[model samples]
Target: MKNSAMIEACLACFAACEMCATECIKMISADHLRCIALCRDCAEICALCIKLEQRDSEFSHDVMQLCVESCTACAAECEKFAAHHDHCRECAEVCRKCASECQAA
Candidate 1:
């Protein structure tokens, strides 16, 4: 597993995104909508990245790149409300780490 570290990072990010989305849904509002959407998207993409990386798919590189983009966008969106939301802060942190890992991978 050459991408073992990246896979771990994606797993953590996926979990964080899920948690963040769940929290955002509970506190749904106009401002939280984008965060919620991004979290969901990020989580889905991370899952796909994990599967692709695990099997060493031919499309793993492309999917990892997409994951990087998604994680970056999701992290930025989550950071907006990080001041008041613990979940957002935590998610942002994980997303950032995942983005870096994916990019390096």
Candidate 2:
């Protein structure tokens, strides 16, 4: 895949979400549980965005819209825990960047 900024942001968001989910899963709490679920969903959506963007799929634009929505929700979820977990803060930052890129794309 070409290293466009959008692609890079999406890939970074995927990695961040995966890491955030892993970290959240390690904690035993209701908030962590919610974050874990959001992170997982965000990771999957980011991965889909990457695949669709790479192939130059006709439906890529539609997928990007979904990606933006997913990223926004994930970012909000992450922000809720960002005060305590560094990983969540990092994930939120990446997700926000990815959402912006998806919108621009």
Candidate 3:
């Protein structure tokens, strides 16, 4: 796929992850603050990577590599809560997929 399209998809996934993370943060009974933090970080990084790719920046590769690492970490964290939370499971899946694409990018 084209770089623009890939970036668009990544950005969309980032938004979804961000929203999921926010909702997860509100789980007062579960208190998944740590996982929510990681998810929020992942979302920010992913969005940044998309912008870097769009600009064709010199550090695009490095940023994308960072994005992959962040997403992987977020995915792992999300997976821990996935069994009990539908949003977490969906967030994990999206993070994994986005990580793969970021690696490819």
lDDT of 3 by residue, 8-91 (tens): 657866986888788886877456887888888888888888878878789888988988888889888888888998888988
**TM agreement with the true structure for every prediction:** 0.97, 0.95, 0.87
Computed on alpha carbons, the lDDT of every model, listed in order, comes to 0.95, 0.91, 0.82
Of candidates 3 and 1, the better by TM-score: 1
Which residue pairs clash within candidate 2?
none
Clashing pairs in 1: none
- Ranked by TM-score, top first: 1, 2, 3
- Candidate with more favorable, higher lDDT: 1 or 2: 1
Q: Which residue runs of candidate 3 sit more than 4 Å off their true CA positions?
A: 1-5, 29-31
Residue 83, candidate 2: alpha-carbon lDDT = 89
Top candidate when judged by lDDT against the true structure: 1
Candidates 2 and 3 compared: the better one by lDDT is 2
Worst 10 residues of 2 by lDDT: 26-35
